[model samples]
Target: MNLAERLRRALDAPAPEDLLAGDLIEGASVTDGIVPAAVLVAITRRAEPGVLLTVRREHLRTHAGQVAFPGGRIDPEDQHAAAAALREAEEEIGLPASAVTLWGSADPYRTVTGYEVTPVLGAVDPDLPLSPHEAEVADWFEAPLAFLLDPANQRAIEAEFRGRMRTYYQIDWEGRRIWGATAAMLVNLSRRLNAWS
Candidate 1:
């Protein structure tokens, strides 16, 4: 099957009941004033598929200099999460919405930061020339999908945040550390894909 078809099937599959779709820390909650956000998990359609990610500008106040997917809080005007993801991708990475083929959305992942993020999966041409927005994105790169989805590469780490011990998944690609909500969402995607397979 083609990449789009495969992605569609994977997304359509029901996530297992035990699958960790959100923050794993105890007492973490998204019930109070939860901000709805969406991210574009852009997969490159090529001989070796990859996932696109970005490093936020260090000067920014929130999540500065951290690796992240191209996205942000869903605006009130956005029709839905998918639209928001597409718009954010365009704004952050200069990736035109027209260039992406939407596969579907994955299960929503809640972060400790109080953002309930919906991940929109899409396929794009591997050779597309993407320009990063200077104010928000510092740099962008693609990591191989195989390496990212591998359970062996997803490492669990415990750290103190807000005076509480929390466990989160981390993936190291080259010198970049992909972790926290971003890595958790990738783990969710991996579970969905593996379930389909």
Candidate 2:
């Protein structure tokens, strides 16, 4: 089967137990209302597929200079999570919504920042030219799908957040650190796909 079909099938299956992960996994608590957000997990169509990611501009107030998927809070006009993801991708990276073939969405991940993010999986052409939104995206690159999905590459690390010891996942690629909610979502995706395999 093609990559899209395989991914869709895997995502469609019942998610394995403990599949949901985020800041809460590390003993963080959120007393505020959960904000709805969506991210595009854009898998490239190539001999060796890659996942497109972005490094936010340093000027951003929150999560500045961090590696992240192209996405943001779901706007009221958005019909669904998929639409929000596509819209965010277009606004953040200049990747047209039409360029992505929607597969489906994985389980939602709750961030310590109070965002309940839905990861929208999609397939896109690897060769498509992209223009990064200078205001939000400092840089953009594609990390190999194999590397991101591999269990061994997902590292568990600890640090003190808000004066409490916390553990989270991190994936280092070429020099970039993909961690936090992004890393957790990738780990969740790997689990779902591996479960099907």
Candidate 3:
């Protein structure tokens, strides 16, 4: 039906107790000595469905100029991964804490850049304005959730990393590249929704 509908349906469907059982950490599979990060898969509450992605500024020291979902590391005082995600998002994008509704946490993802990131899924009202801090979001846009969940639209690209040949999933949308772990997670979500579809 729409973005909100897709998320609602996904959330409403009967899920195993383990699905909502606990917070996930990405350290298990990620390389040793890597810093762990908590990332969020923030969705929009608008009609015709889409997702919010951030384009980091080119001058940053870390992950400089990367396209990422809005989130950062877990705070010491934060209760869980979702809390860290919402807190980081609000701090970076100025999205009011009350505006978000968390769905559930996805599988922990291991990044090539030595980050063990846990992705949290949630939805928010589409009209709320965003103001990013720390990272300069060159732009933000909505891409249909259905488009991302589609397998035919997904593929991988071979690249060299640290002198080793690596494969990364590339999701090209309107010329934006949603690759690596983000693309894989989107693929996972797409498969989940596709079953329901």
Candidate 4:
């Protein structure tokens, strides 16, 4: 299927309730219960389809050394989730305005870290040049969307976030370890796509 077709199918399917892993992002100095943040889990159009993922520079202040969708806390100037997601994607990955076309958004998710995150699914041109800002990103990887959504590749792992053990899915791609909130968000996206398709 084409990128648009894949996204169309995903959006058309029935969506599941947003899964909560019990206060996932708690230690950060922010209030709980849904503060606005946005992330772009963008799929690209190419001969071989892929999803864009980023590795944070170990020097960053938050969520450092982890794989993530390019995103951040919502700004007062931001109008909506899609806008924020696109803007952050551009700021973080150097993806241009012409490259991304917004699709539907998934449910709002909360991290134990005090962010009520809006997960955006978008389609982008794979030809765009990408550069991870020196202080923000250490690397970028594009994994095939099919590889990520396949149930065969999914693994359940247990971890303690707030003195509570929770089951989370992990995507171990090549040498990269993709887990935590990014994995959580992808879990929701996979379900949404499954339902939509």
Best by lDDT: 2
lDDT of each: 0.88, 0.90, 0.69, 0.77
lDDT of 3 at 102: 79
Query: What is the lDDT ranking, best to worst?
Result: 2, 1, 4, 3
On TM-score, the candidate that comes out on top is 2
Of candidates 4 and 3, the better by lDDT: 4
Please give the lDDT score for candidate 4.
Answer: 0.77
Least accurate stretch of 10 residues (summed lDDT) in model 4? 21-30
Worst 10 residues of 2 by lDDT: 20-29
Alpha carbon lDDT at 138, candidate 2:
97
Span of 10 residues, lowest total lDDT, candidate 1: 21-30
Model 2: CA > 4 A from native: 1-5, 25-27
lDDT (10s digit) by residue, model 2, range 15-81: 9886856677455577579899999999999887899999999999878999999999999999999
Per-residue lDDT of candidate 4, residues 81-184 (tens digit):
88888888888989875688777787677766678888888888885779888778899989887778776777878777566676767898998888777877
* Candidate 3 TM-score, C-alpha based: 0.81
For all predicted structures, in order, the TM-scores are: 0.94, 0.95, 0.81, 0.87
Q: Weakest 10 consecutive residues, lDDT, candidate 3?
A: 18-27
User: What number of backbone clashes does candidate 1 have, counting pairs of residues 3 or more apart or in separate chains?
Assistant: 0
